[model samples]
Target chain A: MFQVNADVIAKEEVIPGVFSLTIVSPVISENAKPGQFVHIACNQGGNFILRRPFSIHRIVPGKAFEILFRVVGRGTEALSRVKVYDILDVIGPLGNGFKYSERITSALLVAGGLGLAPLLYLAEELTNEQVKFYPMLGAQTKTKLLRYIDFKRIGKKTYVATDDGSSGHNGTVADLLNRTIHYIRPEIIYACGPEPMLRKVAQTADEFGVKCQVSLETKMACGVGVCLGCACVTRQGYKMVCKDGPVFDARDIIWDKEEIEPTLLGGYRCETAKVSDPG
Target chain B: MKNPVMPASGTFGAGREYSEFIDLNCLGALVVKTVTLRPRDGNAPPRLYEVSSGMLNSIGLQNEGIDHFIEHDLPYLRQFDVPIIINIAGNTLEEYAQLCREIKGVEGISGIELNISCPNIKAGGIAFGASSRLAEQVTAAARYNTDLPLIVKLTPNVYNVSKIAQAVVYGGANAVSLINTLVGMSIDTNTFKPHLGNITGGLSGPAIKPVAVRMVWEVAQTVKVPIIGIGGINSTLDAIEFLLAGATAVAIGTANFVNPRVMIEIIDGIESFLRQRNMSDIRQIIGKVKV
Candidate 1:
């Protein structure tokens, strides 16, 4: 939990509404772990009040760190305005990250759209460890896919799926998983994507008797666990995503349907665990 | 004696939330959220709604109760040198007394702030806050139970806040904190309906600052006890206005949502202003009425 003023070294529009920001923070870059995030204070002293949380896409050793995100709302829109050399107040390397085990020789990486951010670092780490990586990338279209060259360079076998059949396999990534699960026979599966995608992966992994870990996203207030705003339903009960986990074993989550139903207002209903008290 | 900056209860939590971005020890003091006899789940979803310049929240004082707080939060709070003001709310006089009695021996707790103005829950919610008699009774009951300094938190929705402040003071309150979030409502323009799940909620932010400052001035002139002013205090200038209006201390509330580091910024701004004004100490500006 360190606050450092990071300078934007590079900003690139990877796809429509999607961007990749490279910030020069050696301290954060050297310490960041896969699945952890940095809270980027956008437009300091401006109207954008809260800091935007972004998953660390890739940590470039001692040089800098990268965050990939989509311009979903005002916070991200303000972040998109940031240019090269613009200083940002960032607090980071926060929340528990994926615990990579050396016993797992073969690994499966599943990603949907921008969920690919955190997995990129895990992929790099896996390659460094000489672990077999089977990367399953998903996007609405070929244009939405990111870091294609990087994945191709490192992954032992990279599979791609686009919803519109614009490129790669003409199906969802889950459909591709159904076809490739037997061939890869991965020892462990790691996934970060839409809840539906993660649910499908979780169910599939359970059926195949393979261990699975998932990263969840929730509405957060204090990213340090005090607010209890970013809580999720887990097997044990309610657990704060910012503290107990952003990453949890798929079997550990409760995944209640009624709680996750879309609210009358357009936004998703907060599916926080039904804790007796939130303090 | 006056113009101390304090963190709003519940709004500031235990200060650990912002420890990542700002140092909690630098602030004058911090007010932890209202604790109860038992853990409370609080209100349902849609507890918060954004209005023009402020927001309404029906958080309902969701806390881990007194016992859990004493065991878990107090030990962590003791590490900070700044004073820790514990805020406690109760459904009955006995409950309030029991809570006070329990905190009497707590080592880290510097003071106790009686939350007499929670609008979210139906229990002892607005009962103690809406009347001068009940406020006095609860304050006196709490005073009898504990030897710690007591500050009575006043609701802004009352008819005459000065009367209520005076009542709490007479009841043996060491201090008074004014203008707890005002009762407010917001409508969804499209649905033509109330926005918040609780329908009515407490409003806090820059929108209510002026009202809060006026109330602080009114209560300051009438009550003998120290006043901690709160409402929409997002900056040092805001804090200064409350001070000039007669607040011994000011609490930062809704601004935490807008920017987690706003408290540190206000502290720095106040220090800078003091240096620029050639003031030697913070006490010089506390309640120094211009007229």
Candidate 2:
């Protein structure tokens, strides 16, 4: 809950339209967990009112913690204008993050686009626990695909997919899952990606009788869950994405494409499904 | 007195959600939501939008009304040690007086802050705040209802806000808080449409701090009562600017959306600034600048 003006230590263009920012915040670095994010105030002292939420990419153990994000919207565009040593007002390690369970033996990680940012740290945590990792990376094109060398270095095996035929397998990440799920046969799956991709993955996992968890994104007013801005329909009814999740079991959610009406329900809607009775 | 950082109405609920992260008692004061005569559902969706260095919100003063607040929120808020400033809004002058009288004897209630600046609804949207006569009439009505310190909150939308400040003072306001969120709009260029559900919303955050400071300075000079400044206060320096510009206290609004602990930080920042400057009392800094 501390508001610290962090300095940008490094910045890199990971790919076109994708840039990574590393900031210095010892408070955040020490307290942050996998799947947790920081709300960064960007561009000339609060010019952009809402703080952009970025996953704790890798907490470099130094005086400051690091957050990795792509230049996605007006907030990120303003973030790129920040220079080294320039201060950023950051509030985070916010929201309920992913839980790392010791009982899980093997892990299947899935990501699409910038959603991969949080998954990278989850992989790192799993590696420390000596859990076997099956990582699937997806992007629209080869150019959009994140460099996989880091995941390859630690993961047991890594699969890559792209929508356009410019990368590893000419298919969506879900297509890759359909082809490989039987071979890998993971005990538990953790996925973050577009709602459609995650929905399909959830369905596939349910059919296979395997447990799956997903990281949901919503337009958050108070990332701490006070405003009820970021809410998702779950089996229990409306749950605050900022508090109950950013992470939820795939089976727990009620997916509805129509319910996901834009601007009406935090800029994203899903009306096709409702959370089944929690009982 | 302690640390001059208070939460804006409707922004910081009864301080229940904030207790998990920080101590609510450390704040100078706690301002509850704008309570009406009855429970309000608030405005439609798209209640908020991000503007340049600021954000616009049309929450429409949504709350469970005065009776519900007195029965529910007041009991919970009384547990805290800090003063409670009740923000009251109404469609008519009699309604305002009725609501004020209802909370007049509540334990732990330190004062009443008349919310005459909310622009999200039509019935009273800048109606009382835009003119000195209306502002005075509302202030007088609320003042007659309560013996507690009456703080009239002035809107920034009016021309010569100082005149309204003066009117409220003459109407028997013990203090005044200014400026409330500035009215503004945003457009989605791709769809060529407005961004918020209310079409136009009140803007708050760092973008409007300069305007708020100017208004606070102007009102401070014109009115004899204390002035509590609000708008775009995200950091310590911003808080200092408000105090130097003639604010007896400051309220943190939109920054609460970005960081919930912002009020706590501003409180600590003020103390640190005072320590660094070798000042002991906070009053030494308040209204130090006369321009």
Candidate 3:
């Protein structure tokens, strides 16, 4: 990963509290894989001291890349106001990304809320790789279902789910997958979203005996995996989400560590993973 | 030009993560995270929160035991030509001795840094370092347990940091690393609650530089051992300030998050500073503050 000052070419609100920033960084756009992420230094003038981790939303090799974010806290709010031409200190493409396998042909792409960030790039790659896939997108409301058109433009079948019933399916995206998994008969599933939806999807994939990969989100201090702040417990033990993976096999994640409600976004609850045996 | 630039323990994991960005050979030493006798789960979630000019983290010293380090992490770090210093923590003096005994004769290790400054753990962390007597005891126990060079790390939360430094040196420490993260806390105005999951956390970054410099300056007069200054050291100028304040070397901590290559940049900058000044040795300028 290289640390470079990327010039913001475009910054626009995709939704009310969410934004898309197109950055000019050839090195990042050129080497960034589907599941890799960028750690962005927010406006230093603001109260932000930690670099915010964002998944690469899109990449244009030798030129630029795009990242999507939501104004969840002061750091992101500070970032949303960044004007075009403002320089952003970007370090990426960090963390292990989605695993590419030549064995899988039919795949399922699942995204929730801002989780659509990484999956957008993954979909582009799967399309290029001649992999047959379906995009399943979900959000709290229809207005929050981000970039559905972008997924559709890939000329692949896309599905939508929202809690308020304003969108295509009136339940969680996992519900959509459950209803369609049989007909779709996907050999592999890649997901990025709220922990609860991911947990449900992981469980469904397990029952269906399909391989699943998930991208997890956590409050991280150093995106380079030093601080040990963003550790997630797996059956193997504690692993840094920024290093061992921001992406992992669904089977490896210790789903019991976190209790996520199927439909409640804010009802998500998780505890830090314990070090099983330090020795 | 032996410009000693290493990453502080806990801040630089096993040097695996940043090694992908910068060459490990650029550093003077690699101080791995603190390992206690038993595995520590660390604190609850919300382990870190960004402050105004720094961050508050209560990671609670989460690490695999020293055996895990010897069996797994040590081999990976040994591939680099640089010296490796294993930082160790314990709940009691015996535990510290046990850790030392375990690490004794371990290949690829050049030194042991006794961590008596972790603020997050409830027992025998900052507690031992807060008092000169306890600090001396732990330092002496660790010193007696191993033949490796022992560097005692002191906490900034102490009332008389110089006393602690002197006590550790007298207890047989070969050197001392000063000004581990200071104890601090922040409250979320919106939630009317503490920001860190541990309620309070250790603060680090540019905000703590002046205090760290002052502490190093004070400790320099009390102890004869070399001082490894740490706290808010992001640049060569920062490292130079510590050296002038009586530190022989400085470790970069929080800045690693801002840019993984910061330590390398600081090393280069220090070398350039010396070359431009035509200085033959770094010792000529160390502790030369006129004031």
Ordered by DockQ, highest first, the candidates read 3, 1, 2
Q: Over the stretch A1-279, how does candidate 1's per-residue lDDT look in tens digits?
A: 777888999999888788889999888888888899887777545543455678899988987999999998777888898899998888777788877866678999999888899999999988877888888999999978888788889998889999999978899998788777987899999999998889889888888888899988865545666655455666554567877879999998867535633321111123233343375
Please list the residue runs of candidate 1 whose C-alpha ends up more than 4 Å from where it truly belongs after superposition. Answer: A178-183, A257-279, B1-3, B17-24, B41-60, B157-160, B182-203, B254-264, B280-284, B287-291
Cα lDDT, model 2, residue A68? 61
Among these predicted structures, which one has the highest lDDT?
A: 3
Candidate 3's TM-score reads 0.87
Question: Which DockQ values do the candidates obtain, in the order shown?
Answer: 0.17, 0.17, 0.32
Tens digits of per-residue lDDT for model 2 on A1-279?
A: 455788888888777667777888888888877888777766534347676667788878656666666776888888877778888888777767777677787788989877788888888888888888888999898878884888889999899999997878899998888788887898988899889999989998898887898998766666665554455666654566777888888998888735533323321122122233343
Model 3 spans > 4 angstroms off: A44-47, A81-87, A100-102, A174-185, A203-211, A255-279, B38-41, B186-197, B272-285, B288-291
TM-score of candidate 2 to 2 decimals: 0.75
Clashing pairs in 1: B2-B248, B3-B248, B205-B232
- Higher TM-score: candidate 2 or 3? 3
- Each prediction's whole-model lDDT (CA): 0.81, 0.80, 0.86
- In terms of docking quality, how is candidate 2 classified? incorrect
Descending-TM-score candidate ranking: 3, 1, 2
The candidate 2 chain B region of ten consecutive residues with least summed lDDT is B38-47
